[model samples]
Target: MNNPTNSKNPADVVVIGAGIVGLAHAALAVGRGLTVTVIERDDRAVGASIRNFGHCCITAQSGELYDLAQSSRGHWLYFAERAGFWASEAGALVVARNDVELQVLRELAGRREAGQVTVLRAEETTAQLRTAQGTPDPAILGGAMLRDDLRVDPRTTVGKLAAWLQEQGVDFLWRTSAVGFDDGAVHTNRGTVYGRRTIVCVGHDVDYLFPSVSKEHIVERCTLQMSRAAQPAGLTLGPAVLTATSMLRYDAFTEMPSAIELSRTVDSGLQAIGANVMFTQHPDGSLILGDSHTYQHTAAPFLSENTTDLINAEIGALLGMPLEITERWQGIYASSPNGPLLVKEVQPGVTAVSVTSGVGMTVSFGLAERTLNSLFESVHSHRGSS
Candidate 1:
């Protein structure tokens, strides 16, 4: 909904890509009184940023990413209020259906500082789920209630944020492609746009402008298949839900002692295919569910019915009921075996950054703030020397 004609003026920062990363950079720059122009190839953001579960899985993150997620949590709330979007502080309910999974939760709880995580007995978890109109499988041994996560409706969050940014005076150039960049300008299909600094947050399309860096980092595309179901009548899923399979996938839980045993208990096929089940509810009472990860240099744009069926079966076991699926889709994000994120100076006064770990919505705000601060400091230092 932003007017492209209004974006002809030069800006302090020109951000390429209108996904969450670019939008985060523009928001932070504008907040610091810098004029910003954002360019997107699509008329609107239609990428991993919008296709995700809108989960800021704070409790499951580890190391630097964990800190980033914690810092980003406040921004999620702040933007939700300013952008007029739905944001929930509802954490995560990680259900453990067996003793091995319960042991993993117990080990994780023991390692963390007090009060950060709470382990609930099977009866307690069932009672809480029942209160929320969820029917937990009787086989569920217990659950870990991670109190720090957040969720938003992915389908609408970015659109709302982009609109809010326009209201804050940020310019957007829709359907524009950046072919290249120089010292302080971007060469696009429209024309050359000048800026004091340039930041590229193009998500998985790394080869578009920086093929060398993308190749050097071994960046590949990771595809995931997801589905949504009409919420059962009168049911409110109080928190984002995860099954025991999630324990083997999230580093925070996987690094724990009992995780090995839990992993051994899981099906080898699911493990080999990197399938994990997660559920987050939207305000409209629809449950967004997913997903299986498949990585390659170029991901095939096909959604496997087998993967969908596996996801449904896994979640059905936890929910104790069959869900009426309403929609199905697939999303692709950048992935790297080298690191969780890629941040490098692709050229003078231009930085290229990508969230290769599918945590863009989780850590983008904090990461952007840090990136902008460092960039501004470098520019100031150069000016002082000159």
Candidate 2:
């Protein structure tokens, strides 16, 4: 549809979706002196970006993803300062309670170039856990301290970032849906808007615009469950926390030689259901805890108490006490069998990007930088050849 109210002059870039991925592209484009207009179906960002644990588990990533996460951390801190949001560079503590789990930590520490991970002695690890008002399990052999991770309040970070972008001159078209796109214009339900380039960062809604590309890439949905626990009096978590079960989830640790045995010793049900427990404290003195992964074409809009019980039991074993759950929720994100992220050109001037894993918050900014660089480089190359 055409509307006279829509901007007649094409913007430098038009972004679809206002989640972290879309916001990241808008922030980068505007920072580079490009005008940006972002369109979102919802009035506000209420997606995986805000529904996550807000943990930038940089140290737990591997290979290219790890490097992207490290770069994304810099952007997170930069925005956090100006956005007036709460963010912590306190890092993370991955606790190990058995010999096999301890072995995994030791192996990971040996590969320090991968991350700033250090293995801590059992007593030291337990002492650290005690600081957070919980006694560590007596069986805890040791733990690894990842010194490069970050934590933020996901519930607030997205809103703050969006607001900051708005103040920076980025136009946000909230409650507008991009139905389709061509070489130079996006067709939305509201109107047609032209842009030199268009980027789609719709987290998991593949069917909205590029259903064909989404299917060809084997994109699917991953559902997870999370909960918040009331903080204990006088307790402060020094850093985000992870238990042995988390070892089976994070790639940095799972690739270690010791992980095989550690996985074997873990509960089969936990592995079968893809359950992992991680803890991060919030400004309101509540702990954000989660989560289990279930993959499918579409996730059921229902919470499974059995999954919650499994998560609580596993995390309780690590803390030596059960937490009082205050809130429970679920999150779904785009996933792929190929990898954590997928970037493909849906058309000449339209690009589709999805954080096909749950690490969107950790790596979105970095991915945006890389994507924009490639986009502009291609444009320059084509112009020169022509």
Candidate 3:
């Protein structure tokens, strides 16, 4: 690979992936007084970090993650403002379609601290979005939407973050692929690049990096299809969205479906995995719509016509507007056990991580500190045995 950004001077640390997780690690590592260089195969930001809906999901996360996401949102807001990135904290609606689902949602709200989650009725739900699919089943519900999920333009945010990282004195090695590792040298397309410490946040590429660890840490590249449409002038809503499944999927929503409905949702082919619908809008007068999930082994094809149409059908039915189809794309995210989107190790002075998982945008800020602490903290200790 032609190394567009290379240096004769070796770095104190070489980050293997330039995705959000890797960028987060690099930024924090540099801040910790370590000379960091980020290497990537892509010259621009177009992977999961720039592909997904760019949701900073607060309600859909678990205990420590929720707090982490909340803090991440704060940093994103600050950086986004300075960089002129399109960002909004327009809260999300985790709708329930049936009585059973509503029962589940009610349970969720009751368990959380008041205002942590607010349960909305069909009328209130419709009142908020001003858009409805079918009438809520008395037994199933219209669904409950959270008042906190924030949406940012992925392309805008990541592109700017990468630029800012450069300004902050962090080095980048774009269009450079890592071949492998042995001893202390990191094998790359541009040949071995030696460093004092290293980190890898390769998303789906993890399978190739460590085949044995792949089984223990399975990364299913969830292909999500998304669409964009031009919105009529003066038409707008503030928050990103969650399907009805989110109410059940997220820990924040304690009230999930009843035993009966939950069983039905889990069993039915379409509803089984809780694939409902989600909604969000962009400031450029275009709406970011999407997405369906499918797992693939490697190099998963993102642009799919069939699934894109399927997702759009759901959107049209629910939105009831003549949406002008504008952009179409697919995203690959990493999913694994225990739901940590980030993992870091400093052994041999190397840190390999991935957050191609859904919460990359929301969780990156919070995970940055942990990623470094796991690696640099031990090495940077000044208190040596006297």
Q: Find the candidate with the highest lDDT and give its number.
A: 2
**Each candidate's lDDT (Cα)?**
0.84, 0.84, 0.66
**Model 2 lDDT tens row, 241-328:** 8887788878998899989897678888787778888888888888888999999998888999999888877777777777889899
lDDT of 2: 0.84
lDDT of 3 by residue, 1-386 (tens): 45333346767778887777777667667767888787888887678888877778877777777877776666666666655677776777765666666776677677667875677867665544443333322332466556567788776777787788888788777888887775456778877777776778887677677665655666666777777877734555676756554544455543343533564554244353224356577767577886666766664664767656666665555554455788887677777754555463524566667764577777776677666666566645211111
RMSD of each: 4.3, 4.1, 5.1
Whichever of 2 and 3 has more TM-score, that candidate is: 2
Q: Please list the residue runs of candidate 3 whose C-alpha ends up more than 4 Å from where it truly belongs after superposition.
A: 1-9, 131-143, 182-184, 232-234, 254-260, 263-269, 272-276, 299-306, 337-347, 378-386
Q: Please, what are the lDDT tens digits per residue for candidate 1 over residues 98-184? A: 889888888888888887778999987766555234476888889888988889899998899999999999888889988888887
Model 2 lDDT, residue 250, Cα: 81
Better of 1 and 3 by lDDT: 1
TM-scores, all models, native as reference: 0.93, 0.94, 0.83
